[model samples]
Target: GPDLLTFGEALVSLRSAGPLTAGGALTPHLAGAEANVAIGLARLGHRAAFAGRVSDDELGTFLLRQLRAEGVDVTHVVRDPGRPAGLMFLERRTADLTRVLYQRAGSAGSALGVDDLRPALAAGARVLHLTGITPALSAGAREAAGWAAETAARAGTLVCLDVNHRSKLWSRDAARAVLTPLAGHASVVVASDDELDLVGAPGADEETLVTGLLARGVSTVLVKRGGEGARAYTADGRRDAAALPVTAVDTVGAGDAFTAGYLSGHLDGLDLAGRLRRAVTLGAFAVAGHGDWETLPRRDELSLLDSRQPGDTL
Candidate 1:
């Protein structure tokens, strides 16, 4: 049985290989918010599992292979023979800004159904990680994400929600309609400062947003502020973690990395402050490297960050 289970869409990201243009060199990389978390957890010495749908195409096969290579169990993943896998294009103009274009309509991932969920597998996990991106895919995908969360909750598994709201996926209103109710089922809620609108608290300050989510049955809320740092609020009180200093290469998957680090620390019996520290540390690592899951640090690799010398040893 896996320690952590996550359900969502995994897509192939085609990024600009050379120059920025209409028809520039493109490079393919596997990416998905939830999948990235699963990979990160696995890298951090946790047993993680992924549940989602992908087509029986080359891209789909490649994604599955990558997940297994990262030690993420893919037994719950469905390979739909009819629909193709989802795909997205990422344009990296700079280290801080990235524009993503999605071509995932009617894709296998968007067709995820409740029947695709293996509740038996989820029941063995300690936490079920979810993201707002899957629900924004389609109605079926929305239902599937909700079902997985509810199922895990019923089995006494903690539900962790990441409101990774994407403007390209859906409007703020549409996102709120689905994400708010879904968040009520989660034990923990994670959202970026700009994405607090998903919980129907648009433009509200960090304190207000945290209070709102707590009142909505969420026991804990994490507000992620890029570069500035992150804050966590619980019934007991609140804690903060400063962002680790690093020269950022790409910031696209930093949140997922943070979530993975947080979950890994939680499962390892770390205190709230320790979990938050691990989260910020991994978030910094994500930005310092290129690619999504590829940049995540393993448990042993974390000490390398403590090195101040140029030529450091393990």
Candidate 2:
């Protein structure tokens, strides 16, 4: 059994050099929020497992092989032959901006149901990680996400929820309705600074939102500020970490990488400040490269970034 368990949708990502309408070369990559974090944790030498459904196709086979190569436990992943695999297109709009388009309406990943979550697997793990995107997939997936959170909570496993809101999948009201209740079962809630309101109250200020979340039984609230940095709020106090000064190429998947680092530090029994430092460090590594999880550092290689100066060869 793994120490950390995460479940969600996994997609076959196609990267385009420019706009999708411009017609260019497409490069294939394995991508999913939960899978990315699982890979990141595995790279850091953690026992991480990913559970989801992938189509029984070549793309699904490639995804499973890639995750196995990264040392992530995929024993609970299902291969559904009825539905096709989901696909997401990443369009590099400019040097710094990237646009994502999803074609996953009725895919296999969206068909994740309550039975997909193995109670033993969920209960055995020390932490169960989930994201808001899973609930937005479909009614069945939403039920699965909620059931996982409730089960993990009852089993004394920490429920970590990342409010990864996807506007393309659903509306604000719908997202708030689902994510707000999901946060109730979460011990730790990670969200972008702007996304705080989704789990808290709409139009509430940062302080008010964070305070409300803490008051409602959330032990920790982590606010991710992309370039500015990240902040952690708790009953004790708040800790902040500035974003590392690194030239970012692709900003996608950086948040998932950060979540992985934070959870890794927690599993290692690090202090709040130490966890924040590791979180930002992993985030820097993600943005400093091209693909999502390709540039994530191993456990021993974590210090490599700190040892080298900008533009210096190791």
Candidate 3:
């Protein structure tokens, strides 16, 4: 049994060097919010497992092999012959911006359901990490996300929910309806500053939203502020950490990296300040390179960001 478990739609990403209209070359990479977190934790030396569905095609095989090579357990992943795997194209339109186009409707990953979650698997892990993107995949996937969280909570496994809302998948209203209740089962909730309301009151202020979640039994609430850094609120107190000053080449997976770092810190029994520091450190690594999990730091490489000079080499 792994220490941390996560499940969602795994994707084959095609990254374009320029606009799609100026098609030259497409670089392939494995991607998924939950899978990215699993890889991040694995890179940091944690036992992480990922459960989901993928097509029985070569792309699916590639995804599985990539995850296995990263030390993430893929025993629960199903290879469906009837459906194709999901795909997303990352168009690097400019130096500071990247546009994503999705073509994942009716994909195999979105076919995830309650039956895919094994009770014993959920019970065995110390933490079950979920994200808002899973529930947005389909009705069956949504039900599976809720069931996994509830089952994990009942088994005394900590449930960590990352409200990684995607406007491209579902509307805000629809997302709130599903994610709010799902959050109830979570011991820890991670969301961006704008996404806080999805798991909280729609129009509530920041403090009010955080307080409301805490009052409703959520043990820890983490709000990610992108370039502004992040904040963690708990019964003990609130802690804030500034984002590392790094030139971001791609900001796609920074949040998942942060979540992985925070969860890793918690598993290591680190204090709140220590957790926030590690979270931001991992986030900096993610944005400092291309692809989703490609630039994630290993456990030993965590302090390199703090000590490296502009031209310093190890």
Candidate 4:
């Protein structure tokens, strides 16, 4: 029914407007790995749907409106009758350092279960996007993610898994155990170099790490190197793209933006090199923005980062 179907936790992000010590106020925005990807794909002109649970509260209403404003279909989103929506707070101490705090334990999103996977919501999408963070939420959420992946795999839909490990949720060992098999089932696996350890390859070089994931049956392994840019490995060959030079305002959600760019390219039938370039470009856009998904580019706005002539105007 949609081009992309994503399932995960969408939370209210209360990020500090300035340094936490000298904070004037905390700005609220929507934040989630899968949600960010859904918004990014929608921005790029794809029909994307997000399925998740939120509390029937003001925060939940805000989240729904934000997703809808981004053109993401929230038809499958459920509202928890009792528990409130989850919350995440970010405090930036410096340009390169940000501390994240979560108020999500026992929240509605953490309570996601296998029953949440309605067949109609999971089926017929060109791609099913998931994240390791969901499985780390709880046993039920883990089962739900696995069920979604298996269902997508059966339908020959590409299952994209992003290994977004959070130490606060589970141990590295536990994450490795649960995420390794899930990665094997994913057609495409995205992970940061540091996060690769969650899939059992801590401290391994990019090539070694990608090789390990490829052996697990993943068709493509995208190694996100933060400021260094990203590298893609596939059965046919590998391609790398250097990060663009941009003054980053915030680094959060850049990886999700990168994943969206790659997926967009995949859907558009771009070559490996072209895909990597698009991924890096989108990532650069994220870091240069003030909020997570605020600066993600649409197809036409992609050239915003390109050098402009002195007199150029719309």
Candidate 5:
């Protein structure tokens, strides 16, 4: 495939290893749900392009530099005169706890609309990857997200939506309103236990949950659970992956990593079970690193995690 287009915001994140008052190393890096997936696919030697609005300010410039540095096509990124790229503060507690404080309100990314969608993306994409965060941004962004999904589907491209439920961003009713309809346009929908609850899926069980999404028109639904593996369902049946063991670090972008890996597998024509297994493994690899994109492994590095058996020593 020649194209994988992801639409969302890119933030200028100030990352620290510990509590803010206590003081830790502050590093500037690129951060975003879709941006993470773009970088992840690029790391795996796939074609990934990002489409979003960024401020013409310093933060926006930094984000562009970051994505371009990783070989992501950034032709669709635009800078607004009045708005700026969003900001986030990432604090790591212990090795596993990671918290983010957001400062994105009416930021440039959130201000994007359907008219801003690049014609190249609308016409040339092979897959449309989106998340729950976009529609929550604002009315314009929500419309742009839906239009992108619909356009990609009409172009015969597979649409993959990650139902990444973020409570701080918007209300359950609002999220359900936007997500339920967009899910109808996707061939595959990815979500977690938390996302399922927010949208009022049929039941807690995978069968019922996936059935609900299928009724909404998503043929493939994957429910991801941290450290507990993932359950994947299609028209045929469902399959599960055994979680891979890894020492946890920051938990910020593991779900995004899972989206990156599983979608990569999906594009490569991997089986349902194989895609879930790869997704879980890739997510574990993401936790083993420092920043979001810094730790994402290339295709060769991904296999190293599975080299060990149960009895093997680290």
Candidate 6:
């Protein structure tokens, strides 16, 4: 019922029974940062679409199937028969920990351009969710991410920007230059403490950093601090709450889950504190599952967390 479209990479993931995916991992659920958020939103009963580049090869098709299975609109997902879908290796370090290694080179996700931006932000879509990783993929992909922000603004969709800074992909200066401007156009933003540091506020306190974002035009900022809980600042107010306790599991997709929760609350018109709690619970659930996209809880399950024991209701 909402106008939400999230754009980013979707790669086929392999879970190796052995140490790694140097041809030893078992095939598991396929997912990525962008895919996880899109699926999460769809599962929350919102009509979501993913707009990004994917290879036309088998892996690309597999990615599409997963999206469709999760009820995500795949029309905006373009296939590049000339390229191949990227692949990733996720290794379980322990029952509660995992290590990931990337092998995404020459993947079709790098072929994005400005044209893909407008179509995905088509009429009826109210938000365009983006991450910092897409811009790090390639020049064209970066342009596409920028275009998505600009196009979404032109279309009147709120921009939801997540500062997922992967230092392995780009330098701090490069990240600040690209992400800060894109963030300037967003009304809502999510970032971890470390990411905000890379965005040129390497030593600013949480309060000042988030306030800086509002000064730059963003109305809402959610700073996610693992274990310590998360804090949200809005034009109306700010709130700090504890993260839900759970047996810690894989940490790969926790941030994405937090994002999904906040966006769901945003769509539902929940207040600041209500949104923070939902975000925390979903993050706890993400690490509990083995695979990234596999562990994502649907709206029903998330609703259950809001029980009668003096809990916040959606």
Q: How many residue pairs clash in each candidate?
A: 0, 0, 0, 0, 0, 6
Give me the displacement of residue 187 in model 2, in angstroms.
0.6
Q: What is candidate 2's TM-score against the reference?
A: 0.97
- Give residue 35's error in model 2 in angstroms: 0.6
lDDT of 3 by residue, 1-314 (tens): 78899999999999998889988999889999999999999999999999999999999999999999999999889889999989999998986778999989999999999988874354489899999999999999999999999988998999999999999999899999999899899999999999999987787898998888898889999999999999999998788899998888789999999999999999899988998999999999999888899999998899888866776767
Which stretches of model 5 miss by more than 4 angstroms?
22-25, 93-96, 199-206, 309-314
Candidate lDDT scores, in order, read: 0.87, 0.91, 0.92, 0.88, 0.82, 0.79
Clash pairs for candidate 2: none
RMSD for each of the candidates: 1.8, 1.1, 1.1, 2.1, 2.4, 3.5
State every prediction's TM-score relative to the real structure: 0.94, 0.97, 0.98, 0.94, 0.92, 0.91
Colliding pairs, model 1: none
Q: Model 1, 217-240: lDDT tens per residue?
A: 788798899998898999887888
Off by over 4 Å in 3: 119-123
lDDT-best of 3 and 4: 3
Off by over 4 Å in 6: 21-23, 93-97, 303-314
lDDT of 4 by residue, 148-203 (tens): 89888888989999999888889888899899888877999998878876766656
Q: What 10-residue stretch in candidate 3 is worst by lDDT?
A: 115-124
TM-score of 3: 0.98
Report the Cα lDDT for residue 120, model 5. 48
Clashing pairs in 6: 3-125, 3-126, 15-26, 16-25, 16-26, 56-80
Order of quality (lDDT): 3, 2, 4, 1, 5, 6
Model 4 segments more than 4 A misplaced:
19-24, 94-96, 120-122, 201-205, 309-314
Question: For model 2, how does the per-residue alpha-carbon lDDT over 171-248 read when each residue is reduced to its tens digit?
Answer: 888999899989999999999988999997899999999898898889999999998889999999888899988888
- TM-score of candidate 6 versus the correct structure, residues matched by position: 0.91
The positional error of residue 242 in candidate 3, measured at the CA in angstroms, is 1.2
